[model samples]
Structures are given as C-alpha cells and as structure tokens.
Target: MQIALTGKLAKAMGVELEPVNDEQNPLFTWTANWTTVWDNRRAEDLLVLVNHATRFTVAVYQVKRKDLKGMPEMIKQAIANTLLYMNINPEIVEEYMSLCGDVTFTRNSNRKAAAWVTRAGLDTSVYIGHEYNGIAKMFRDTVGASINYGLVNYSGKFDDGFMPYEKMVTALTELTGKQAYKYRAFELMVTLDLDVYQAERRIIVPAGLEFTRLHEVLQSVFGWRNYHLYDFTFFDEKSERTTVLTEPLDEYWPGDEEIVLIEGRVLADFMPEHGTMVYTYDLGDNWEHEIELLRVIENYDQESPYLLEASGQTPPEDVGGVGGFVEFREIMLNPDHPDYETMKEWARFWSPELQDWEMRPRAIRV
Candidate 1:
C-alpha cells in the first residue's frame, strides 16, 4: 500500500520522501489542517485520509500537535474504525494492507488530497463544536451520510453515476474470496399484527443500515407518513429479556432499563435471533409490526433496500387501532350504508391512491 503524506506531515515525521513508480497498487493520501483552541493553549489538527481509487474520505482524525508522533498507529486505528463504520470486518485490515503491497511513503503527485480534505473539512465543520459527539462520531456520521446520499441515492459526482462505495466493496470482494463483511443483505418479512387484515411486506436491506434509516425504509414501503413516534423491540437471548431501541425524546420511561438510542446504532448490533422483533409505531394507534429475518441474500446488487413484495393495504393513520379499521372496512364494503361515502372520503384523504377503491400493492425500492 502506498501512503502519500503532505510535506508538512512528512517533515514532522522526519521521513525522507523517495520517488516511486505509479503502479496499480492501492494508494491513499493524507492531509491535515491545524487550528489553535482554548485561548491558544493547545493546537488541534484535523487529519484526513482519502482513498485514491474510490476518492472516498476513508478516515478522519483529530489530534493535538504533540500527538502527531504516533501517527503510524493512529492511521491504522482510524482505518480500522472507518472499515467498521462501513460494516466491513476490521480484522482484514492487515490482509488488505498486505494485498495492496508494502507501505511506501511518497509525496502526492496528482494533488487529489487537497480537494478531498477540503470537502471533508467543510462537510464536518458543523460538528467541530458539538458538545456530545466528538470527531470520531462525526467521522462515522459523515461516512454514513456520504454513502446513503451518494451511493444509495445515486447522487454521486461522477458523470456516469458511479458509486464509490460499491466500487470499493466490489474490489474488496474480488480480493478476498470470503465475503466476511461485504454488507450482507437480509431479507426481512414485516407483517402488521392485525387480527383481520393480512398486511405483509417483504423487504431486502443491507445489514449495515442504522435503525433510524431502517425506520425510514419501513415508512416508505408501508406508505406511512412518519408522523409519529416508533420503537423497535428485540429479544436478547443472553439476557432473557427484550431491549428497546428508539429515538431519544424528552419523555419518561417506566423502568430503569437502559434504552438504546437509534441514532448511531446499526441493525447488525441487535439482530434478532431466529425469533421476531416488534416494531411499534404511533403509541396512540399502536400499530405493532412483527419483523422477522427470513434469510440473507447472496450477492445482492442493490445499494438500497426495497420492497420485494407487498400484499394487503395498510390501514390509514389515526384509524383508532384494529377495531376502528374493522369498522371502516365494513362500511367501505357496503355502499348502501349511510356512512359509506363519509368513510370512503376519509380513507381517500389519508391515501390518495385509493381513487379506484381498490388496494394495489407492488414492488418498490425505498
């Protein structure tokens, strides 16, 4: 692996730069921005590393001027953290480095690191003064946001709409025969726990998705407006209890049980074992969904999760739970009934797709 460092970092490290051939080996470049803080008592530097092939900001680190001496170990740890953030096994760090070749120090020739580091610095500037989340979390969030927005959303800067994340994953999969951390795709069966209606949605999502993004995928596939609170309950086999993950809110929970925040938690962390997890939405309406992981799809090509199949129309929001849904369905079945037109109009208000009075479910990508 070739790691190119800026002249300042090279000078700080007391390393002599040697000219090398531009081979096909994987290359990464490092750049930094220094700033003084706390009344100029200490100097802070933002170290940014960019993958030359993918042009992805692979790792980011914040450190003091004195800590630069241990940059060799810091770079390794940062790469491991970035790989973990991408849902890739960090254990392959050494193997990946070996596959790329020996570590060679060189001065950047293409001048690509400056642009990438500048973009990273601008994208992460808002988190510089954040009270709770430090630079590590900020880097994780930046990486996730970039992947979701650029790769999954197909909004990359390339003219041909190339995705850097996909390219990197494909390269790694080819290099390593075992797909240990290629982001396994899980096929999930989500069924609405209703006594009458048979609403079920089959979805395929990458295991690396965060709970918050998974919530959005559910909302899109089920045609929900995402207007209410929701929580995911997963059974912990070891603890013999259920754990709840939800968005942090200023409300009181009944027990002292630790509630996990869904902000930075990925689905792989609390994957439900052969059993089912409950996704409860809208505390008032109490729409409980039974989510089951059916199987893992091998070699899934999609960047984002989608609805593989759907059946039965979902109930409208604020329909007063299952009883109200039953009553509404009964009225909708009988046009001669007095409240038929009223209920139909109200249902149409919630879902404009009910124009033909028929529920049509189809496959869709979220």
Candidate 2:
C-alpha cells in the first residue's frame, strides 16, 4: 500500500523513487506495508508524518461520520489545531480550504475521507476502506506543479513545511477553469558601462516577476549589498517619452519628476524583446548599468530567476563610482603606493583571492 502511494506521489511530482536495499533484508519486496499499530483505534484518525529529507509532510485523517456537511465544530477545531501543531502557515491553510470548496463530496456506506498534500510540503496518504478516490485523485494530479510567481522568496528561513501559494494556485488553475496569464522567460544582458568597465552578466527570469523582484535579482547578480537607492530609466519610442521606475522616496526628494513605483509593475509591462534600458544605482556614485533584452523564451518551465553567465567582478560597495574604482585599481597594482596595504585589505575583503577584476564567465545560482 505504501509503495503504491509513493508511486502515485512520485508520478505527481515528476520524479522517480528508487527501491531501497538492505543487506539483512535483501529479499524484501518493494511493496510497503502499513503497520497494524498505525491503524486507528478511536472513532477519528489523524496521522501526520514529517519527511525532513523532502522538506514536507503528509497529513491524513478520517472523521467519525460519513457526511462532510454540518461537520461538528469540535472536529473542525481538532483539524485546525493539528495543522497548527504541524506548523503549517495560515495562508496555506486558507488556500487549501479554497481548493476544497471546489470538490464535491459523495457519501456512501463506507467512511468518507479527504487528503490534501503536495510536493515540497505535503506528500500522499491513503485511508483504508474510504470513498475518497476523487479527492485523492485531485491531490495527485496537481503534485509537482510549478507556479507563475512566488508570493515570497523562499530564503530557507521560517519555512512552514507547505508548498508555495503560487504553486498551489497553479495546480488548481485548470481544475477551477480560471484564466491566468502565461509566464514567459526573458533572457537579458546587463552590463555596467560596457564601453569602459565591460562588466556584464546574462540572466534569465520570468516575465511575471515584479520590477522589485528584478531589482533584488540584479543586486544578487552584481554582488551589490543594496545599500543605496536605484532607479530604472527607459525610452518608450511608441509613447515618445522617457519613463523612470523608482522606489517611492517622497520624503527624501519631492521632485516634479514622474516616478512610477516598481512594486507592482511586472517586467513584461514595459520591457519587450530587444528592448534596452538603463539602471542607475547609488545616486551619489551615479553608477549606470545598461540593460538589453536579448531574447524571449517561450514555454519555459522555471519559476525563479537564474544567473546564466557572469563576467568581470563587481566593484566594491561605496567605492566612489567608476572613477573611484579606476583610482583604487591603480593603487592596488602599485605596491609602492602609500595606502597600498589599506587598499589591498579592502579589496581582499570583497574578493578573498583579489580576483575582483578578473573577467571570467561562470555559472551562479541565486
């Protein structure tokens, strides 16, 4: 039974599970057997299994009654408490409830049960002698599904052991028959003064990503700590006007310049294939980065931005600008300079091997 369940889950997750080998139990079959001890003894059964290897869990339960309608408040509270105990986020619980509303339950002599789980959080579970094939099938069909965009970045902190909200929404998109925008992959060449410095990178991201998210990705790719203000400027030939997208800093500078907030605008709203723009970081330093839309990738399956290729290390933060970097480079190269040791220490802090200026193509994961 466990083997069958695992196979179903693997199919949903687009992955394969290999058979386990044991020296002492070499003849053991691949089939999984549910221990009798795990069977429910009480009127209600609630089983929660956490698998840290996959960073997810499996929750299965069976109520005492056959009908789901007019379920007692006590039973609902019990389920809610169990979910809280499992550290599942409230947002995920809400999404599950929303999806559950679409399912039509059929009650029969056999007990009725429902299971909700997904890859990267919940997996799969089966109840004995239960008429929940519909619910189980729904869960299995949407496993391993990718979403257009993530509600929040997964930074390996405060993990709620649930699949991302976007993934859940995507999985339910087809079932709900809701119209959703298809995300397109974009390949861009970002250069910091290609005419002189020649620092550049190749990045691929989804068109659905917000400009703010793109800003964060640029900081990661350029090795910037994001300590200063930045803005994106582009010339719209159709509109025949220069558009500037920047953070809202009304308190700092209440100028007449029309500055569009980057929070809600998506990349595809303004950037098209072969489009070009300029990104200025650190107003004081006036560091300008040239951004060119190289290509548009159709039917790509990735959800997050990736650093495809990078060349020419980024300048150290707060190093006065391009001119400052040039001066610092000269001092570092000349061992006889008065501040050579100090500059060398600073350079080593940013790049341990002093490879800050090395122009080499490399693959980096963000």
Candidate 3:
C-alpha cells in the first residue's frame, strides 16, 4: 500500500493520506468524502476508528499498511475494493474513481470531498429507545411514523406518510411533547429450558437487582411464594410433550433425543425496538407451582438472571430438549443517512455483530 498525490490540493487542507490494500479492498485508499475521511478515521496513514465507529470497519477491505509514495493509487484501490464489496458494478466504481483524478477540477468541494457523512438527521439525534421516546411516540401517533430529535447538524425535518423524517417535528409541536433518555439496569434472560412445556417458564430479571423491589414484583406477578422447585412441560403445536420442564439439557434421554420446538411472540411496550418474546408451554404438575414463578419471571426483567451465550448454536433435532434452539435471523437494512454514506458503510460492518449479540427485551409494566 502506498500514496502518491500528483496535485497539491489535498495537502493544502492539512488532509492526511494513506495507502490501503487487502483482500476486500485491493486498492490503496477508499473513495469517500473529506468530512467522512476526517470524522471516521484518524488523519494518519494507518487511520483507525475508535469507539462505536469501529463497528463500521466491516465495509472496508483489509488494506496493506504501507507508505504514502503511492497514496493516491492505494486510496483508489481501497475505494475500488469497497465498491466491489458493496456489489456495485466495476464500471460504476471506475467512473467514480475517474472523477477523483479530474484535472479540470480546482474547487474545494471537489478536492475536500472525502466520503459521505449523513446530514439528514443533522439537527436531530435519532433515539432508538424510550429515552427520547415521548417526542417519537407523539410523532408516531400523530404522523404514524418514527420521529427524530437532537440532530447535531440539522434544522430541517423530513416528513413521509410512513415515518418521514422531515415532518416529525411539526407533528410533535402540534401534540405538545418533550422527551429525554434515562439509562436503567440491563435485563438478563436466563433461559434454562425451551418454553414448550405447560409448566415451562422463562424468567427475566435485572442483572444486579435480583433481591430488591424487583424481587418482590417477581413474587407478586406469578403469585408464588418461591420458585426454587417446580415441574413444567414443553409441547409442540400439536400439544404433544416434546420436552419436560426439568433442565436446559436432556439428561434422562439418550444421546439422540429430539426436543419438540415451539415458537413464541415477543412484545415490548415503549421500547419495542428491544427484542422480546411471549412463549407458552405446558404446566404439567408444576403448573400450579409455576404461576408464582411466572410472576417473578415476568416482573423482574431488570433483575432477571439470563444471558444469551452461544447464538446460532443448536442441538440436533433428534436430541429431545436440546433441539429447542431459536435463532431469529432477520436481515435488517443498512442504509446510508442522507449524505452520511460514511455511517452507512459503518453500519454494514457492525449490524451483523449487534444482531448476533442480544439479551431479551425489557418487560415494561404495560
């Protein structure tokens, strides 16, 4: 990897340069806007992103760390590789690359443009949770779409029939609302068995508040004095016993027992963006005992003690209870925000990992 700029335009702006080359990016540098280059990466040749921005690295190819002798070419290589990774036609990528070397251009915009940073939510900060949800909810209820707020560099709001960003503020103004974000305890889901049994129950509680007010809430919800000992059953759609509510693993069966798997719906109140599910299983004998257990499981979301360990890991279908692994594999769109194409590239890199690692959604007192 190397960099070699034929003109003095990039240097005059104190713009740092680098040569990138690797399997994904077979070029020297990535084609991006100037602001994007500055915001997403360090100005140094071996530019790297820190914090949440690092999640966006997935969009780039591995570039060989080298010198600036062929910096432009290397940057071009990285840009080309990035285009290819993005599934753009080679001809289209080439066209964009050619623009970078246009000798006729002399203006700052053309020279300064490094990569795209979205200005769509410029003045708005999109809150994905309930922290700023009051405005969003008002906007959604009034306009029937998600509204944005507190954008760092935006003033104009967008409006679409379905979640248009522009008109959200107007709608919010009409509704009279204000919103803020407050961090609470992280809920943990300690799932031990598939929610297929009658008495089969899944408990959700906060990570650390297991013995506080939340503990009492859990006790009251299921009407149980204690849930230390109970029996439950797991059943399939046909109402047949697939697995007993004994343990996460099938200890009674031989090596090749198949679990009767079941599907459940997940629901969240204000923070619907958080993952959730409602599973129904057979109560069996513990059905009476588990009523209280269910209360604790449902109430102590912030104090629950469950963490998703190995996703995409499932036991063979022939292995009874071990086969109830549910992998919610949905491909979410990773689109760029207006001109902030830099964030788009970053999202493509981080989305997959974030989707893979998730705790159960928080349970509100809806």
Candidate 4:
C-alpha cells in the first residue's frame, strides 16, 4: 500500500506528492490526504482519499468535529461536490436523505451500509466519518444494499479509532451473528454427566434455537439415536426460581406451577448468563445433561448447533442410566470374567473399538 497526495488541496495541506501512473496502479494501496477538495475547506477538519487496489475504486472520507457548530454552508457545498463526484442520481439521493433524516452512524450502521452496497452490485464500499450514517442508511433502507464492513472497520466508540485492517478482515470472514439476524446467539456449554462413567460432551448452540432443535443437536453430538423424550429445567441462582420447559407427555406430568412448553420457548428467554439447567432425556434410562450458558454473543452468525469439544465416549442408549452404564463398561473391560466375552461382543457390536477408551478432549464441528 502506498500513500500519495494529489490536487491543489494536497499542496495546501503540506502533503508530499507521489508519482501518478498513466492508469491508476492496479495493486497500489494508497491514502491521499486532500482535506475537503470540495468547495467547503476547513483548515481544522481532515479529509482522506482511499484507493482500493484489487477493486480499483476510489472513495473520499471527511472527518470533522462531532458537532459542525456553524458549518452549514460548508456541509451543503461538500454534499453537492460529493453527489457530483459519485455521479449518483439526485432524485434517488433526495428520497434517501428525506427518509433517513439526520441518523447517527454506529458500527452496526456501517455493517448495514456494507450489506446495502454489496446488494447494489457495487464492488466497493466506503466509510465517511462526518455524519455519513444518514447517507449510508439511505442506501441501506431504500435499496437493500448489503453494507460491506470489510472495506473499512470503525469501532464506533469515541475512544477507539478504526479497527486494525487485519482484524477487521478476520472479523468479516467469521460467523459473527445469528443466521436469522433477528435473534442474538449464545455460546452454551452443555455437558453430560454419566456419573461413574466419567463421560462428557461440550456443545454450543444459538440462544434463539428451540429446545427441541437443541435436543436433536445434542443427539447428534453424543451419537444418540433420538429414541426418547427430553426436558430442560433452568435454575436461576440469584432469583432462586426454576422454569421447566419441556415436551408435553401424555403419560405423566410433573404438576409444577410453571411448566412451559419447550416447543415455543427459546433458550435466551430463561437461560441466564452462567446459570445452570438440567436436561434429562429418556425417562426410562434417565440420561441427564447439565447445561450452562457460558456467554451470550450478540450478532453471532452460527446457523446450526455444533460440537465444540468432547471428552470420553457417550454411553449407549437404553443402558439403564449411569449405574447400569458403569456396570456394563466394567464387565466389558474384565476379560477374565465368564460374562466378559458376551458383554464384549455386545459392546463391540455397538462401538467396534472397545479397547481404545482414552478420555481426551477432542474438538468436533458437528
């Protein structure tokens, strides 16, 4: 990337000039500090010119004090010059300005702008700090442009400046929000306590995900075949309240004062940060799982539940809970016992590799 100064504005700002190519350098990253090349020049204010190398596009950013104070005429002139330079239709811009009308720009506002620009079939997106959110919003709300935050990353905080370019690019590539865009996502740590079996699984899912969907995700994570009923009971330590959100069963009901249907409720509604929840599956076998909300991540973009980490092998379903599973495992390990061959055969039939029972933390995506 190279920085170059151009035009009369550059000379006025005491910016050092760089050689200009016949055609703009195809892969040169340059910053041109030409303060308000448009009519309203302020000695105190700063302007920047950014040229995107690969995209071969140029954009101007005007940075000024939060409050313009008494620069209405300057602002009007800058707006006119920008409109002319960008070659955007005046009628469309007018409609957008009228619709947004003095909106503040935030980090999300930048994201929305990026989304909009992407949708508009434009290859580039720009960031202008001087109250440009209104214009960005106009592009967003009107044309449904997908703002590309990748172009320029601003922290939107008064203290923190723009995020480092590398970090910004990394953030843009990763899953940073819920798939639905309406609900905030959460990173939960669900662990199954097999008691004497000493087996557990660490799983994560979105907060807005239904408990029923979570049930299926857990089934996959633990290698369960989904052959039993499950229920989730959330406990808030601070408030000392228990909320039972579970599937409705015809055969039995716990008769609790507040038994909510799990089908409708989301995890975020009841699961407090660092709070605990008990998830019991298969009433007959009583496979219990302990769930804790580790953290709530706003604007996370993980669409499906996935296994983050795991330890030990999951007990086979219909193994008569923890005690039965422990006993079965012991029997299979004892080769000298009379029933060892029979139990081994059964275990091997289900698991295949019975000898490789090492409890090590393994990371899995699904």
Off by over 4 Å in 4: 1-183, 238-240, 252-256, 352-366
Over 7-41, each residue of candidate 3 has an lDDT whose tens digit, in order, gives: 33245334454432223221222222221112245
TM-score-wise, the better of 2 and 3 is: 2
**Candidate ordering by lDDT (highest first):** 1, 2, 4, 3
lDDT of 4 by residue, 211-325 (tens): 7667766776667877777888776678877777776767546676557777667677775653778888897888778877777766554333545566667777787888888
Show model 2 residue runs off by greater than 4 Å.
1-182, 194-196, 251-257, 352-366
Off by over 4 Å in 3: 1-66, 95-155, 160-366
Give lDDT per model, in order: 0.63, 0.50, 0.28, 0.47
Best by lDDT: 1
Model 2: per-residue Cα lDDT over 1-366, one tens digit each? 011123322333233344332331211111211111123442323223222112123333432233223222322333344333222344444444444332111111111111212222222333222223322311111111221122322446647434533333344344345333234678889999723457788888776666766787788788788788899888877767777888777753546455677767888888683299888989998889998998898755443466777777678888888888878767866889999999888766664222533334332222
The positional error of residue 200 in candidate 4, measured at the CA in angstroms, is: 2.6
For candidate 1, the clash count comes to 1
Instruction: Between candidates 1 and 4, name the one with more favorable lDDT.
Output: 1
Positional deviation of 132 in candidate 3, in angstroms? Answer: 30
Please tell me which model should have the higher TM-score, number 2 or number 4: 2
Model 1: per-residue lDDT, tens digit, 21-43? 57555544334433322233444
